[model samples]
Target: MKLSRLGPVGEEVPVVWEEDRAFDLRPLTADIDGAFLSSDPVAQVRVALADRRLPMVGEADALRVGAPIVRPSAVYCIGMNYAAHAAESGSAPPEHMVMFMKSPNTVVGPNDDVAVPRGSTKTDWEVELGIVIGARASYLESAADARLHIAGYVVANDLSERDWQIAVSGGQWSKGKSGPGFCPLGPALVTPDEIDASDLRLRSWVNGEPRQDSRTSDLIFGIEQIVWELSQYLILEPGDLILTGTPEGVALSGRFPYLTPGDIVELEIEGLGRQRQTVVAG
Candidate 1:
């Protein structure tokens, strides 16, 4: 099942997409958040759909698509998890996962305008597969056990500003990653049963020109391992977002120019969905 939040930002309503139709899930939950997922959102949605208890909303295209989940506890990211991306950025695959955090406030509706932070020139794009957690996970015993904790997945654009990320601020990547609207997520939250996260094709384009084009199959630290490894260091709570890293072809690789005002960025993860954002001056 595909889940989503639709409407203007901060006023979105929970919704379910099935058979090419959108149905309001407000009768079941106020918002799709950690609390909602913890209550077994999939099973509840199934019952609602089967009982015909959900109200049929208009076509999904009629509403503004917000990020699939609201106010996620934290937004975590794996850096250089793709070997090709690492090579493009002039780094080798790390022996251990490299993790970073983005301010939750950076989360925005998939189609919203992305602001180029003031005095910025190196804003870049990363198309990644985002994993939404379903249950609390701590010190997971194995990579296999990690799969049980996943609720769903979404397409994500891990927008970055290379200048602040590397040149200034003493090399803390998160510095450039935490700007408002830095993370544009959604189109829909696809449940695990609906899509395979193992080897999906993910890609991105800037103003109609293809930039990043690669597959999750190239991930050095796959989904299960990312969760398992992260669990050993930090608790993975329901509704937490994990950006599983992006494949090669980002502007950071220096092949393309950094984003500027009026540029449009589009991202897609096979089966998860697509996202488009227009860059605007801050």
Candidate 2:
């Protein structure tokens, strides 16, 4: 079943999305966070649905959609995992995965407005497939082991500001990446059983024009490998979010102009759902 949170920010209640309507998920759990996911909630949701214990949500479409999961303890990102994206950014694919972090607080609802940081002229957009961790793991022995810890998948917009990332900040990327609503996630939190992440279409647009159009198959590093490798260096806590990297077709490539206030940015990943955000002044 598809899971989501709706209502005002920080007041979102969990719900399950079916074909025609949403079913209230609060009867099963208060929120879809680390604690709820670690309990093997999918099976529990199935049982709840079988018993008709969930009530249909009223006017769900009118409510705001929050990030499917709560603010994670950490938000990790893999950089240049797509070879074409690496080339566009003027680099060769690394022999080992490159990683970085975005402040967890940067996350916001899928359709919320995103602000271009003040005095910035190079805000860009990246569409990426996101992995949500369901179990804690450290020093995982293999990719198979890492796979067992996954909760599900999501669509993510990894917004960046080229100036802070490259011209300043001593070569650190997060400086440009941690602005308010820099990470807009969700519309749905798809369970693993409902999708195959190995290869899926990923696309993005700016103001109704197609920008990035690529596939997860182009990824140099897959999800399992990413998680397994990360476990070796640090702990992967439940509900942690990992952005699997974006494909080519961003403003950073210089083929397109950077985002400015009043621009509408849209991103999508097959099966995971879509996100649309309006650019606003910070």
Candidate 3:
């Protein structure tokens, strides 16, 4: 079952998308009182969607799509996890995974406008496959167990400001990555059972041309390893999100061709769904 939050920010309602129509799950249960796309929602909604009496929503409803997970305890990201993207960024494959955090407050619904911060010139876009942890996990020994902990997947745009990311903050990448509106996630959260997150086609387009395009097969570290590795350091909470990282063709891959006002960005991961956003100057 596919789950999503719809309506205005802070007032979104949980919904299920099926056959192009949305089922209003908000009125049916409090599990959806807030964002219900995190870990447990996978099982919760599975039962909810099975009820034949639930009311279905129409396509023209004035609902806004919010991030798949409303309150991720932490937004973890892996840097250069794709081999080709690593090469394009002028870096050799890392011996160990590189990680960074994007503040949970930056989360917004997909299709929202991406704000290019005032006086900023290096704003760029990254199309990444995002994982929502379904259960509490830590210190896992193998990739097989790691897969069981993932509830589902969502598409995310890891918008960046190169100057603040690298030139400032004394080299800590979080400074450039933690701005408000920096992360736009979800059109929906597709349960892992419904889609194979391990092998999917991921692509991004800036304006009208393709920029980042690749298969999940290109990832240097698949979802299982990354999740298992992260659990060793931090407590993987029920609603935490992990951005598995993007593939090659991001604006920063070469020449640093970043986004400016009036540009539109569109991205999608097969099975999970698609997301689009417009660029606006702050």
Q: What is the per-residue lDDT of model 1 for residues 87-199, given as tens digits with 9 covering 90 to 100? A: 99899998989999999989899999999999898999999999999999999999999888999999988999888998995857899999889999998899888888899
Q: In terms of lDDT, which candidate is stronger, 2 or 3?
A: 2
> Candidate 1 overall Cα lDDT vs. reference?
0.91
TM-score, candidate 2, is 0.98
- The TM-scores of all predictions, comma-separated, are 0.98, 0.98, 0.93
How many residue pairs clash (N, CA or C atoms closer than 3 angstroms) in each of the candidate models, in the order given? Answer: 0, 0, 2
Per-residue alpha-carbon lDDT of model 2 for 1-282, expressed as tens digits?
Answer: 689999998899899887858999988889999999999988999899989999988999999999999999999999999999999999999999999999999989999999999999999999999999999989999998977899999999999988998899697889988988899999888989899998999999999999999999889999899999999999999999999999999999989999998999999998888899999999
The Cα error of candidate 1 at residue 118, in Å, is 0.4
Q: What is the lDDT of residue 97 in candidate 3?
A: 95
Q: Which residue pairs come into collision in candidate 1?
A: none
- Backbone clash pairs for candidate 2 read none
Q: How many backbone clashes does candidate 2 have?
A: 0
Residue 156 displacement (Å), model 1: 0.5
Please give the CA lDDT of all the candidate structures: 0.91, 0.93, 0.82
- Candidate 1 at residue 105, lDDT? 89
